[model samples]
Target: MGREFIEIFEEWAKDYDESVAGQDPQYAAVFANYEGILNEVTARSTGTVLEFGVGTGNLSEKLLQAGLDVIGIEPSQAMLDIAKEKHPELTVLEGDFLTYPVSDTPVNTIVSTYAFHHLTDDEKAIAVKQFKEILKENGKIVFGDTMFASEIEKQAMIDSAKEKGFSALAEDLQREYYPIIDTLEDIFTTNGFDIEFKQMNHFVWIITAIKNKE
Candidate 1:
């Protein structure tokens, strides 16, 4: 399922943003929630910012618009191509989040949106460790992605997606990646990050973590 997920997202990269743009109001609200999360964490920009899995540069555009110096790492060439076309001035690289080229100086902030859940357990842990390694002492990481919700809540979201014609992919994801939030939190905490904030919106969980300084 993990490898298949990568293939599916890579294939969908070209039209990812457009498809999302036409999402139902509830799904659109998830993106809005992300904006609020970003605003809260990045109220005062410091140094360089790195984004993992920046598909089509949607969140990257918002970061750029906020006047932050940003670079994005995406494994899918198709996604990077679209991201480059959309934000020609920004630096977008093709690489896996766990093994991507990172600056030696460490970035002040690392952010990812709806991408981490695609990773396998080992990959997810490595990714979190890598984030800790590449973040400055006082740096932070913010992310928004789906998580396990109540059966009722989950079903409501599933039903909503079905009504809006998003069942195929949505159902696939619910089966594949929906219960990793607890593992994600553990990974971050084990690797020197404190889960600072968390919110459950529909079927998604938005989170922010600050790298703990020794």
Candidate 2:
């Protein structure tokens, strides 16, 4: 079930946003926080930005409207199809981060919203290493996703999901495949990212890290 989860998501892409549209304001605010983080990390507004796992162009549109050259990499063609329709001006590629062909032009800033939590521990380490390899000397990375404070908090989240009539359970199940925050920070620190900012909401965490500049 864990390994087959992405396949399930690919199937869900057709109606994913539609099913959650009315219920996603809180999640949307999370993405908004990522936008604010981007603004703080980069003074230049026109440089290239790479967004990994860009689902349905939600954040990509925001970056484009801010006057940045944006490219999106998404593994699911179903999601990319919708993103391309919504944000045709931005370049979008259908590829997974593990083996995706990074842009030849050094990326100035790399941002992902609610996407990194899908990587396994090994994949997370590889992703952090890859992010360092592709970014410019002073490039920044901003990511926003759910974070659990403790095992108790994690269990509380599960119980809350059952109480909420299974609202976000599908998303939660998807996250079970990846490493959450406690381990995520170690991956970033080990791969050359210096933590810049971290904030927590009820159940979500947003973080920004800068690739160390010598």
Candidate 3:
């Protein structure tokens, strides 16, 4: 279901950095938001960090600077290759976050930025369970992406997009291509994880969930 996104991103890899300018008037604001995400992730845990959808090493590069060994799991080889080329020491496996192989070393933290919407809501549930299996007791999982606080809120965003003629995007949002923050919290909290989230803007959110085994 997500392969089409992979193809689009693969072709966009080369110009990805510049492409943001066309879509966003305040392009620098977007990168700044990601930097905020990096700060939050770094402050949350200083253990082994695994980043899913580590596209072009944008977020992973900062993780490395924060002195964490990062294993980046990316679905697009084109994006993977770019991320790898920049951080040769980084271990990047060509894989999807929902089904990436467990890390050989027990991980203490996991982070993903602007990703996860590729998975359906049901798929996200499976992914979080998989995250629990790979993380050590009390390990932290923090991710920043397009997450909504409620179904009504998500629908509102979709409706706004549709009004602007972003029909495909609206359909994607309506269909399970995006995550509802409430649904995600229920999945993790019921399974023994502590959850916290901050909405950065109307369309983006930063969620931090730590495994509470203690």
**Best candidate according to lDDT:** 3
Ranking by TM-score: 3, 2, 1
Q: Between candidates 1 and 2, name the one with more favorable lDDT.
A: 1
lDDT of 2 at 70: 84
Q: Of the candidates shown, which would achieve the greatest TM-score relative to the real structure?
A: 3
In candidate 1, list every pair of residues with a backbone clash. none
Q: Give the Å error, residue 13, model 1.
A: 2.4
> How large is the C-alpha RMSD of every model relative to the true structure?
3.3, 3.7, 2.8
Please give the TM-score that candidate 3 achieves against the real structure.
0.86
Instruction: Give the lDDT of residue 205 in candidate 2.
Output: 63
C-alpha positional error of residue 111 in candidate 1 after TM-score superposition, expressed in Å: 0.5
TM-score of each: 0.81, 0.81, 0.86
Model 1 collision count = 0
**Model 3 worst lDDT run, 10 consecutive residues:** 21-30
For model 2, the superposed segments whose C-alpha errors exceed 4 Å read 1-4, 24-46, 167-171
Worst 10 residues of 1 by lDDT: 37-46
